[model samples]
Target chain A: MGTLYEDRLAEHIGKECPPIEAVDTVCPETIRHWIEIMEDRNPAYSDAEWAAGSRFGSIVAPGAMMQVWSMAPHWPQRDLPELPIAPVDEVLISEGFTDVVATEQSQQIHKLAKIGEPVTFTVKLTKVSDREHKTRLGVAYFVTFEYRFTDPRGDLLGTQSFTYMRYRPEPESESADEPAA
Target chain B: MPTDWMKPHLKYDSVAWEDVSEGDELPTHVREIDTSLVVLGAISAARDFYPVHHDKDAAIAAGAPDVFLNILTTNGLMASFVTNWCGPDWDVTDISLRLLIPAFPGLKLTTTGTVARKYEEDGRQMLDVEFGAGTDYGPHCKGTATLRRP
Candidate 1:
């Protein structure tokens, strides 16, 4: 396998390809579990009567819950067969890419996701950048990617932008000179 | 007489509206960022490929001081603090956050907020909530939030 930097960059720049893949996952249990774990006592997420009387008209998933749901499809083990896509972990690990970092993330909630509604997430690698910084190993390249989320009906729910910088380790003896300056 | 179902978490049930002031400080909420929660949050949010969140070595190699906090996790923490204080009756209308410093794993962070301004907007009571997160090192993030009272 070649370096992830080389492979991903090639695919991104050469093929005019989108570095990130879009995938979807649906499991009512996931949302239910989140509500329980967080101890979210909000009637909109737990009580049928309260939810029915609310604007959403059902036990809608919390905004933060929907954010979590959006990322479920990227886990390595699920290997969403319908999409024929690799989990983000497998994809990065396969290309000998390591050290992914999220520099920033911003989300805007447009609407709520109701219970029993199959929430579909569309993860796309919106941008990629190669950055070089002086380190013990001199300079290294860093790659960043962004992912956006939407519902099954194609209504925009929120957007999450993640920046990951990838690079190899620097060799020793490269910075042996020591000068007090 | 029937009891109010939402009485437990309501401000009216305990404290009176006259007690809270524009500059009065709310109780502070503190948390330490652990690698496990950070990783779980990152993966769960579909931010799957970032190793710097889970891999310490990767973070060092990338030019970051350490496995830094993701923006989503920071936002979640801020939102949670507000919700915890205001109770479930209030809803978060908007949140604007700015990260000042990197919050690494094991760092002690304290979240503090104050009522900046309050007014009636469209027949609903609104509170201009200002929040911030700080560590022993310094401030990590500062922002304002809009909360509507029921």
Candidate 2:
């Protein structure tokens, strides 16, 4: 990667992107679909009777269902004009660093959202590795994107932090020339 | 990334907060990763279209053995592992994960957790549980999460 390009990448740090628009609200139907794949038979996530008789008094969405609320759409549509929240992935792809992988993730939930409440997200470019890393996947740069989720009533749900490695795989030959970073 | 529901489904009574002791062992949860629908459902649920998670040729080209599981799915698995063991009222408050190896199609993941500490914090019954998933690749994923039994 050129120094100028690297500098441009560095510029992304601290940049805040607009929140995803029209986030799907949580509902029993959505919750059921998730528990099906997870086999998460916890009554609270699915059984209305069990949930209503409990402290929550209604069916509660699983707290771990947080990230699914704000994942990047499979088909990309431009939502925010002030800041295109998803450019780092594009930059990585453009730079031939196409092998993407998640390295770490963490979340702190203020509380779980209720059914019929919409979930929205806002993210910030938290970090760009100062130095390139070498691995079986060739030279890679670490990109960390942090997300915050809120419900329709302006209540805080939780904040999720995850890191992705944008890597270019090394060629088969042991002595092949490598790109400059 | 489990697709079909368990054959003999489970019915659980909410574990009493007082009954859970520090150093208690939680039940093990096994996740069989079938590359077909199971893994696909997981990635699709997250809307994660990254090729490494799907598309066999793209995954091989990207240096992965095959279409592999994504972290969001792992997060769900980890949460379910804890919540299932702690019973109905128990919920996950915080979870942090570190992946040591890629979980592939043929892999079988056996997840277990140990209660590290149980205490009352601000009148909330809390347990800090350390959990891990064992795969064909050895120790695959490990993390600690806080679960609250109210």
Candidate 3:
């Protein structure tokens, strides 16, 4: 009747992982590519002159784009080396840890990210908990992580708080498909 | 004269200082959650790498009735809906959201918000907007957003 939560928590507790950081360098091409890929038509992210005239003075990356920037460093690229990443769900899943679900996401934008401005990201684990949802009849563990982004001048650009719930299969009688309590 | 940046055009203002009432409903908009777009969005947002969002087989194996939307994507959709209505000039000061149900893939999500309250804070005109998004299953997400006109 034990759950994967207990073992996952024990492995993560008191473990230290290298933080992710990058330069503030971004270009119009990068911004355009992201917009095109995401199908975002916001002028603030497309038209340079329009963005320049605004309070930000240039096209800024979308708040959601920052989340991608934060994770980029953790991933391996053919060009960048020496950047260590602590494998989380994606990698762990390949190694037998399964049942990852996004529980929550929140973001706060302080300043706009202009083209060619290097925005750095740093991530850290904040919380982890094991819970049994009787209603769903699932064994799940909640993991919370914090990400901070800053401009080259050390000014706070934004902060993102992400919460994830990873669950596992239960017995037939205790399945998540059961009727609500 | 760069396209006459200051050129005057037909202007019609809807909400006046006194016309707004508490608990008034704002116009709602529907955003179809394209499964492919949702998966791309999840990767772009660096959200939890849950296959229920990207891989159909993984989702089915994970015990999900089917592939579903990610919470982060839902929040972004809600924010985008409000921002689209409020125009590009408004700044989102705060958003408090709660996930109430699971949104299955390919289902169109209807996002609506109401003017919960209107008041002046720190000499700025602010509106307390509450938003809810749902599909056929029920309400998927609910939250309150604090918006200020710049």
Tell me, by lDDT, which candidate is best.
Answer: 2
In candidate 1, stretches whose alpha carbon ends up further than 4 angstroms from where it belongs are: A1-28, A32-43, A46-56, A75-107, A119-181, B1-20, B44-49
Q: Return the lDDT, model 1, position A170.
A: 45
Ordered from best to worst DockQ, the candidate numbers read: 2, 3, 1
Estimate, for each residue in B4-74, the C-alpha lDDT of model 3 and write its tens digit: 32123211122454666778887887767677656765665434465667887876676666667767667
Give the per-residue lDDT of model 2 (tens digit) for B15-52.
78768788889988887888853355566556567676
What is the alpha-carbon lDDT for the whole of candidate 1?
A: 0.56
TM-score of 3: 0.75
Q: Show the lowest summed lDDT stretch of 10 residues, model 1 chain A.
A: A13-22
DockQ of each: 0.20, 0.44, 0.29
Q: What is the TM-score of chain B in candidate 1?
A: 0.82
lDDT, candidate 3, residue A18? 51
Ranked by lDDT from best down, the candidates are 2, 3, 1
Which stretch of 10 consecutive residues in model 2 chain A shows the poorest summed lDDT?
A172-181
| Candidate 2 wrong stretches, greater than 4 Å | A1-6, A72-78, A81-87, A171-181, B1-12
What C-alpha lDDT do the candidate models reach, one value each?
Answer: 0.56, 0.74, 0.62
* Chain A superposition TM-score per model: 0.58, 0.81, 0.68
C-alpha RMSD by candidate, in order: 7.9, 4.6, 5.6
Question: Cα deviation in Å at residue B41, candidate 1?
Answer: 2.7
